[model samples]
Target: MTHSRRSLLAAGATGTLALTAGCLGFALGNEPLEFDSDRVAPADETVAETGYEERTVEERTMERTEEIGGVERDFEASIWLSNYSKSVDYMGQTREGSAFAAVSVPGMEVAGQSVNPLDEMSNEELLTEFLGRADSDRGDIENIQQGESFTLEILGESRDVDTFVGESELEGEPIDVEIKLTSFDHEDDLLVLFGVLSKRFAAESANVELLMESAEHPIDT
Candidate 1:
């Protein structure tokens, strides 16, 4: 995975909010979460049919601060993430495609917000934070056109997700792309999936959806 794209995904992972009305009363903890990359990521055989190959799966630690009762508290959060990508030569040019999944710490409260910012955050706020990356000049994605919200099955459950269409520059060449963004609870953590594929191939390919569907939570042994 490219450094710029990795950084973009890391930023998006940190900005994700998983709080909901049912979770507002949960206690806050300062201890960092733990994750096993193998258990959280999809199997290689599963990714094979998706067209994109699994590039990397690892644990990431991020630092965040929140103010509570006028006191500043720093928190270290853990994310188990995976990157899938593929490259195809088309019309004498190389087109790049990618997708990412990050498992979020359940009940982690974001900074600058009250006790339970996650629960208080609206759909607009959450989507805004997730999609904000598309507007970054430091990132390759640009000219984002957000589409409607709908429900889809992920990790065996139906969840609301948003779709986006955009353009990105790869090695000085422009490529049209389609994106799907969704977050849902699985086991004890919240999983977020951000998928992007070449527009030309998206219609004819179900790779992105296949990648998501094939993921497993690493059943306990």
Candidate 2:
């Protein structure tokens, strides 16, 4: 999200208050939360495709907040770059949330590397093959107790996800918020992008969608 200088000031004001509340012990963290299946459904169909067979680009900006360790942190604005090609498509998603931001490219591959390693495997196969190793390397998802924090989990080289949580105080009231980003590769027909940008900051989430829509490189039909 492109933010005027004025908007940054407003976001800072909101963040300052949240930080204060956190310091006062008004917020706390929760255990590793399970993914809410009802809140997020897998994307089963293509949303939009370019007619031309050449590379294309799109851009968007948004501002939002998330709950981390129970405290709310504000994101002023963010940018992203999505590029697509014939052999493979890459969507680079980024956001400046809280104390830090990250950039991720989910559909990347090397000459001998696999695209969708589990393409021929069932969900159970995929989980047993990929996640079993990951869980061994990274401890089981545990709850975080601090207020306003971030966590990044590398599910695999081809798939990874991150989440940020914070608490927001607006108009003398407290509100919980969370933002998450999850991306992974699929079969040749498509790629997968999953993430959440929520809170009173509407622009933060919009920026993410804007970047996806304004991908610079597109697949060649």
TM-scores, one per candidate: 0.64, 0.22
TM-score of 2: 0.22
Q: Write one digit per residue (lDDT tens) for candidate 2, span 54-138.
A: 1323332333445433345433222222322111111342322211112222221112222223235432333233221211111
The C-alpha RMSD of each candidate to the native structure, in angstroms, is 10.5, 22.1
lDDT of 1 by residue, 127-219 (tens): 455444321222456777778877767677887777777787655668786777767656645556666666766642366666666667743
> How many residue pairs clash per model?
0, 33
The stretch of ten residues in a row with the least summed lDDT in candidate 2 is: 31-40
Position 140, candidate 1: lDDT: 55
RMSD of 1: 10.5
